[model samples]
Target chain A: MALHYSPVLWNRQKRLYDLTMAGLMALYLIIFCTLQTSLFPPITTETIVIRATSTLAFLMLHVILVIGPLCRLDNRFLPLLYNRRHLGVSMFIVAAVHSVFSVLQFHTRGDVDPLVSLFTSERQYGSFGQFPFQPLGFFALLILFVMAATSHDFWLKNLSPRVWKTLHMSVYLAYALIVMHVALGILQQETSPVYAGLMGVGVLTVSGLHVMAAFIGNRRELHPNAPATDGFVAVCDVNDIADNRAKTLMVNGQNIALFKYDGKLSAVSNLCRHQNGPLGEGKIIDGCITCPWHGYQYLPENGQSPPPFTEKIETYAVRCVGTTVWVNPQPYPPGTPQTPALLKVTTINDEN
Target chain B: MTPPLRRAHRFIWLLLVVALPLGFLATRPTKQSPWLQEPVLPPQSTAMPVLLRTIDADSLVLNLRQSVRGTERQLEILLKQPFETPSAVVCIRQEGSRRAVGLLNAPGLYRFPLPTGTNRPLVEIVDDVHGRTVKTVQL
Candidate 1:
């Protein structure tokens, strides 16, 4: 987070990510064109580039979508989440190349205006098999342009994280449009079942991954280790938690993670502010509870990230009696400093 | 980045690189290549007489008649639908030889040169969009 806007905050990791992405994009175009020319002679240059870029951008989008849920399911996929915006912008660039070349190839020399032709080329909207798909692609590209233009953190800060997230979610809408664009446009003319089968595989892969991730998250939320008590929920025994680790508890419909760190116990909201990452799954590093996804951290005592970064989460009151730990269902505001629950001297030996 | 995450990033790049060749192989075209097909004549019946009738909304008309210049034939094709640049080709095939005669976007009479000693030549028109056959006339 920054008070003032800069084009980008480039770090070593971001540089490497962008460079690799660009190189892969270039390599894809080169290889695609080479194979097209070699396998199918007489293919025009414009057609080759247009198809290559469209397929490349489509493939990149699928990868981007896969990374999100994959990262949520496993922390090992976190690096893809770091420079995801860069990949998004690159996809947009490739998509734009496809859109331009398509217009030039299909609409340019027609009697009507190019834009008009794009809309009116296939006038049979009444028939689903022959629907005018260029409009769908055009609108999807517009949404992608909006998303790419505002991918920077500057927009995230000004628009608020919630709004930015909501806006970005329109990517799913664009994805739907792209699916229809291909289904009604290219798939209509393409007789080979291979292309259709590939498209189906892509759709199913993305949908299946997201559904699996959501199911796993929901199962974790539905069942918690904490037993129901009067007002406070009895979490795991004080000895059950390892140093710098947490025992996740569900209290009053809220997931609260009770952390044991530096011989003290603290409870904070399990949900990370960014992307709703699971905080309980993360461990304390450098005195801060680091989120397994994207590495966003929050102080254990107060659910606030370190100074200069304004991200925060709700903190809960907790206490340890003998060897057992209990947490109050009530939660304090973000950044509220709740006193750390003291561990009993007798319970110290119980920690393994 | 953590070691595991860094490894994942590298894996994604590798997958992307590998996906290119794999995608091409998976989508290998199976349709008969136009180049590989024998230069066979289009469907034939009787030669069409000359006419100046208006073209249909969705069809381009090909008027084939004996050329005034010689025993050669001429084709007066009119495109009722919008087409790309004036690069459409009128292909004529007789026996084994196939000749592609270029035509402009504007309606005009094009010299339909056929192989010598050929009486009836099969004609096919290929447009810029998709290389689809816009019109075919057997003459």
Candidate 2:
């Protein structure tokens, strides 16, 4: 919800989020280092740093990945989704530290360049046991660098939400690479089953949550099977929608958000202009349909953000006939004003 | 998220559900334990014994042997005592270039096939944790 882009539009919530993240990261490092030093007396400082940061980054990545599906499954996790970029950036920094120390420790001693040695050190590509796992990690780090670098809204705006989202989706590839990196690298040396078991649980949890969320999302999609009358599809009764909230409907290949607010009904594109967040999941706050993901707002009548904000979404023609809300699936141009279909006072009373 | 992205997400996880477990199963270590085998010196080997000391002043007996079969030269090393430091490696340095022979995990006989036509090779036992050469021997 910014008019102009700066380095970071920090607010009280963002500041609190960052502070909490930093504190938790530091606490994790302290606990991990303490346990490592006490358990393994012969471990070096570099090894400890490498292990601690790598584990922290991996754990943070798991948390970051799960946050998305968790939000989709339950709105209670939306707060975590709001500040996820910070978590991603922090994870990248920690992962970069791990990559730096690993290269310094393992590859710097060689006569050839560190990067060259990292790729060419073990040329057992044909063999699964000796596959070059470090390169996978390096490429994963590269993807993370790109994601962390373009995490700001400025890039999101310039690149467009679709491209930005597609680029950020590479995090899944990075996660896969990291999984293989660990499976083929450290898991080979470490005899303990605990490490492998924990990794298995992480993979299962991430994949499982995503699958469940997708299933729930598919089930929740409102498909209008009722026949259309005069190009207007009867989506639901006016009282079916909660006040100030919306019910998303798919009519004539259009995803529409039918919002009921102030005894009136307005229909707009379900997709928010900002990051394509689900507008239907959001509620009208102060007469603006606020996006649930990042609080990007749009006026219910015209699908345009309030003054000073240029963002807009497509507005659909909606009308109420005998308490049944009918919406024209064809969308008007973004920011085009449409008269909201007024619900009967009796309908409002029935909702109450 | 858009419908396409949702489909892609589901597809990616579906693939991962199959691929990850397969990868984990495929990469499981299949090689035999090196420690289980008895330490046996190679036959027809010329042993060049050398005394090496660690930074902690512990003496180590390193028996380096070169067994030449036709044009191939193999370097065989037999350590009398176990290397106490974890992640230690035996490296061969020839003309300013160093190459790790193998991990020196336990005191035993180890064989590494050497590159042909090398002069004045130096063998060093390095502590990988500290990144220091603990002991060195010229051959």
Model 2: pairs clashing at backbone N, Cα or C within 3 Å: none
Clashing pairs in 1: none
Error in Å for residue A67 of model 1: 0.5
Q: Per-residue lDDT for A210 in model 1?
A: 66
lDDT of 2 at B25: 64
- List runs of model 1 lying over 4 Å from the truth: A222-230, A237-243, A247-250, A273-277, A322-324, A343-352, B1-139
What is candidate 1's lDDT per residue for B4-117, written digit by digit as tens? 332343444344334533433333343222234335333233444443232333446656555344465555555565456445667777787767755545553334434545
User: All models, DockQ values?
Assistant: 0.06, 0.28
The number of residue pairs in model 1 that clash at the backbone is 0
- In order, the first chain's TM-score in every candidate is 0.89, 0.96
Q: For each candidate, give the TM-score of chain B.
A: 0.43, 0.51
- What C-alpha root-mean-square deviation, in Å, does candidate 1 show against the real structure? 9.2
- Chain B of candidate 1 achieves a TM-score of 0.43
